[model samples]
Target chain A: MEATTEARVPQKLTSKGRATRARILEHAAELIYTKGVHATNNEQLRRAAGVSGSQLNHYFPTKESLVLAVIEWQAERVLAFHRSERFAHFESLDSLREWAGFYIAYEHSYREGCTLGSLASEIIKTDLDVRADLANAFEQWKDLFRDGLERMQRLGRISAEADPARLAHLLLSAFQGGMLLAQVARDITPLEDALRAAIDHVQTFAVLPAADAPEDR
Target chain B: MEATTEARVPQKLTSKGRATRARILEHAAELIYTKGVHATNNEQLRRAAGVSGSQLNHYFPTKESLVLAVIEWQAERVLAFHRSERFAHFESLDSLREWAGFYIAYEHSYREGCTLGSLASEIIKTDLDVRADLANAFEQWKDLFRDGLERMQRLGRISAEADPARLAHLLLSAFQGGMLLAQVARDITPLEDALRAAIDHVQTFAVLPAADAPEDR
Candidate 1:
């Protein structure tokens, strides 16, 4: 996570300074999400955050730095949720289904699109440093799914024939793509269809019932 | 297709007029694909297309109109390829597999993200008119897959229980998402994994061997 955030604030920051920095980032993220990275300039962000120019500069030296920090901020928030108590382990297909359901049911998912996904669409055109940071965030996020799938494979819920890493990538891609379509349509049907298809694909490698497993019999 | 292109050129057009209009669209699409809708202005398009400002204006009265025209242009090009003799009918899982293989094997899929998809990411953020045009393009694209799946279902290759429309949307979502991930990673692995998962999911609805089809036996 530290490596992901090369745009870190000063180590000796006071509590008030930390609050101010966080405030700037919160507004910047909101602006970037609703508008876009390029459409959002320093002036609009300054007014939106209610911060002076120098203060904003003090926190984020350049526009690129500010963008990077926002990416880092969003990555932290999204990754934290995934790493939370309930979503941390995807032990079964049902668990993954629940996670997918969260995206469909969540208000922000409907209103805003996937937070990270929306940013990815805009930021992929930015410089290499920003893209690398965004890519790293995506890798870390994908790893969560991979870790869960690996657990399922080890438990024999998913067959060893299935590759967890590939499945994880599949799930994430479906999710990002689903979220984008849903956003475009302003309807959740696309997202629902995509997750169902992805989960169904994973189920293809599900071990057969006891009737087929003579050892169980 | 005309309905999709409410941004149509004038009813009366000399052949030269039509060619000049097309030149503007071709250059605009290229610039928009490489740069973006917001970043690629009329001036840049004028220079790229080797046309005068009034000429660019003659075809596209407004920037919004130009964007719609590009979306329509891209839609026609992409849909044409899908509707080509070889790809028009996805009669079997093998046909779909070959189509997916085409994406992976295609240089453009690796070099530039999806043609329509890149426009989609940016245009989705614009006004409803632009978004509507983009959405229509997507829906038309989705129908190509749906039509193929319907053919498969009618031929009894895919089971009757599967909804062709939903599966079509699923395939489109996977492709969109897979392409975006590949663009970010600059590798084709994510797209491959996503398409594979989607195709495997479609395979689940495949009718089993004659042992399960007693009538055939």
Candidate 2:
């Protein structure tokens, strides 16, 4: 069992120290993402990050800490992408569709799979701290979607009976599953199908006027 | 990179040899399921299976072969469970609901997560061969549901407009996603919510008589 050096992360550091720390984390994230956590070792981290033993120890006292940092780094990047203007505001069906489209296109272009999701799948079962951190990350991600769905419900775009929290969870689950299937199949069809189904399910809740309901169907 | 010794597997084996091989595969599967593939090495496998190095080598010439064998073993078990009497033969909405119930129960009882899905999520990005094996496993699993849904369509339980293949993919994706989230959260709510949403989506296609349609809603 690797120990976590939570105290090692200092409250203050020089600009150069911060840059070095960031470089190490970035390199470690790439290796861990590509080769998995167990297969990655300290020696490889040192070689990839071009950091000395003392420098690595100064930033992360243990392998577990390094992995945790990577998880945090990846989570921030994923959340930032979701929070971008194109994906953040989802009050309308058109915006939701656009978000779905952007997700599929990004997945197709970046075939490495979801960074936080891949990390969560690999380590969540074994490491307690990592699992907690991942759970928090997922909750934060779900909140972003939930907030948008709540707006939709308030504006009467969707039915009053729709549960935003559960819908957000369902959509995220489908996205995670779709990413896993796409990575295994090395094709975009599973993701496309999953998102399409999710979006269509959302559409079912659309509060259409009686005059337009028959023609819309 | 791990070298695969494909040519080492002999074309013929006696009954005793087959039993020994099965024992090795069973042990490897257990370890891989609990600890993951990279963490389970040859020595642990030998100790757990109570097999000598030569015997282990006789059965599986490479680590890769053992992992692949474990994958095939797990895939067969999963497919068999799905094909059992309780889960098989879905010709009506009631049968589909029963299948969904069986799945949720199984997931709750076995808290480790979906065997093939866990394996797929962990190794899909790193190993092409493993990814191929997992993709085939998921396709076989999906085919079972697709067949059942097709039967429902043929029997007029579901509308003809429902695409069984796509729906099967959608449901399986949700199941995989739900299992992952449930494992991470250490709760069954995610799995329950995901399956309920999927089952409800499927019910939307039910072919109801005009007289009973309004009341059913």
Candidate 3:
């Protein structure tokens, strides 16, 4: 009886409550994207989320907390997909081509600048914790790329010659740099070209069976 | 005798108490770069520039104004230098190579991030005037790149069939993305690789004057 009631009651949220929270985040992300973080406030959040003031505060006790939640949400949904099936078992040129295709499509949807990126740039002075979190996200992303590169190397798809760590670093850099430029320019040329070059370069050095160490002069 | 006063007097800045205002901007740029703009305040600005609080106000009525000054200064220096010199004549691979060399070496000194970028990120909810200026800078940069690409097409360095405007847009995106990643990750490997790849791509197309489109089937 207790289990039944508890399941129906929700550990803390009803289906309705979950939906409401999702709605709040959706609007909040939009506001944060358009307005500066400082300019966004709880009152605006309440109105935009269509919730009462008390509920808004209930879900998010503070603006910083709310922003942090949003950052985490984006990190999970937008950035973490790579760690899943998408980038998992990355070893072949086909996998890379598929990744590139997905990337191009995912990138086109990024009409607004990245919420985490926006916050990272804006909140550096106002909040050290937020800055650290954003910085940490990048580090993790680099790690993922490094892992992917290593997998590729082991599968005989990448050059054991070039350092996996270095390749990963380059790939991540080009990806982020291309996105930044695309955000401000409101064009995809920078993104497409940069990615095209990066993918082609990666393909060029795809591991050959006869790969050997550099010869001594 | 008159030279003594001329030397002692602060060099005439442009109106808006122009020269003194630029001094404020110069100091502000250095501060914003290292400290991150959010942490740097008006009093800090006054102290850093060796200007009295009143003098600081005399030049920049508010923090935002000082920020605007810095934006204008940085845009003019960084973008203009590239846009007018190597970038200005960017019709050939040779010019692209020279510019890339200068940019990467200069970027090594950047510990904080691009001043303009740091400001834009921080100014999320800043005054519309500031946003407008930031937007203008982005527009000017794209335009400059576009102009360079167009000249290349006209000179027959790049394929006449190539889209100069599109190429320029892509270059800007790649460049900015490189900078953003550098700031977040605190490394230059990605920037170095992206720039190198871009230069190589340009050279492959333009340096040889082979009279053929490299990417065409």
Candidate 4:
């Protein structure tokens, strides 16, 4: 839906106004998640968020702006959840495996796939304004993995030849692809296989020193 | 759109009618590729295919039916293209590398992401009927790679321990993920890195003879 010419985001809000804005965003996010961005209209948002037309307009001057905010929120939620569980501190190969296991389990339990990923998929072709936000979210997620791999390299757990940034992008790609396949097939096998293959590839770069090799008889 | 109660797919058609049906599907596929399924409506299809309302209804009683036919068409088109280029003959690691290189080049050339993949991502969450067709299409795509790997294993190019089915799934997942990221970023780097990593992982299972090992001084 197109915004009116007069539509504008409010310059500032009081504490109560901020609470209402958060409530509206939370509701809008759920609506957008359940119903796709194109399908979910402003009227639906107004009803779901229980905000007046003017109130909704004050926060999000356009539907695109609202969708962008939702993307950011979803990214923050995913990153915070992962960070809370030590997902960013991949000290060794074992930690990476543990993270993969947990990721698979989470996907199985929560069948809705990645929120940001689903949004990105739906709007990537049509919405130019949202692309930057979606790309930024993906980059942030990749950065977590890169930081962990870099730390592992510094500790000599990973070999020097492994490019942390490239490898991180590869892992993230496998993850997004695996989750999508798993969702569509209604099976976790694809996700498991993809993640395992990616992690095993990472293991190939483990710096096993000569001291760790067994002595010949 | 929901099918009308009176809507029904004609049980039989003449050769001329079949030709028109094929034309309709081709046009619809192109429209869906450009505008997405949800955005492309019956009116657009009628105009694009130059078919009367009765003719369109006679062929596809519902939009869902048209989408299903498009999915099948895309699957066949993709498989046929791959078959023409020896996609199902991974006789050696070099073949796999060649396939990956060709895949990256094709993605770069065609700015639009994978046709079936974009469709799957759009409809997977909401539509149940389309999900089965999408899943079948993906399986057929994966099968090409699986068959190739299986042939390699039988020919002793790959180790017995390497599971062709699993490895094929991994490669397919990576490809899907890479294509998506590349499409969003408008850069070929993600696709290149993901594909290279996947091919390298496949290489790890190569059955190397002892004679091929470099000799110590």
Off by over 4 Å in 2: A1-8, A107-110, A209-217, B1-11, B107-110, B209-217
Worst 10 residues of 4 chain B by lDDT: B1-10
lDDT of 4 at B104: 83
lDDT of 4: 0.77
Residue range B1-217, candidate 3, lDDT tens digits = 1233234334654465656666777899888777766678888878887788888877677776667667677776766576575454675666777776676787542355665666665653555366555666767776776677777777776656555555564465556555666666566655566566655445444534444547543
Residue lDDT tens for model 4, A142-174 = 788888899999999899998888788778888
By DockQ, is 2 or 4 better?
Answer: 4
The whole-model lDDT of each prediction reads 0.82, 0.78, 0.63, 0.77
Find the candidate with the highest DockQ and give its number.
1
| Lowest summed lDDT window (length 10), candidate 2 chain B | B1-10
Q: Report RMSD for candidate 3.
A: 8.8
Q: What is the DockQ of each candidate?
A: 0.64, 0.59, 0.29, 0.60
DockQ of 2: 0.59
Put down candidate 2 lDDT per residue, A1-217, tens digits, no spaces.
0123234446587888888998999999999888878778788989999999999999999888888889888888888777888764777778778877877887442376678888888876564377777777788887887888899999888998877777776778778888888777778777777777877777778898666787866
Clashing pairs in 4: none
Pick the winner on TM-score between candidates 1 and 2.
Answer: 1
Q: Tens-digit lDDT track for model 1 on A44-92? A: 9899999999999999989888888888889998998888877648878
Q: In candidate 3, what are the lDDT values of residues A175-207, reduced to their tens digit?
A: 665555555555655556656666665666665
Q: Write the per-residue lDDT of candidate 4 for residues B50-163, one digit (tens) a residue.
A: 999998998898888888888778777876776665654666788878877887888442266778787778777664388876777788778888888888888888889887
Q: Number of the top candidate by TM-score?
A: 1
Instruction: List model 1 lDDT by residue over B10-77, tens digit each.
Output: 86878899999989999998988877677788889889999998988888989888888888889998
Residue B209 of model 2, lDDT score: 66
For model 2, residues B1-217, the per-residue Cα lDDT tens digits are 0112223335488778878988998999888888776677889999999999999998888877777877778888888777778765666667767866876777442367788888777776555366667778888888888898999888778889888877777788788888888887777777777777777778888887666788866
The deviation in Å at residue A177 for candidate 3 is 2.4
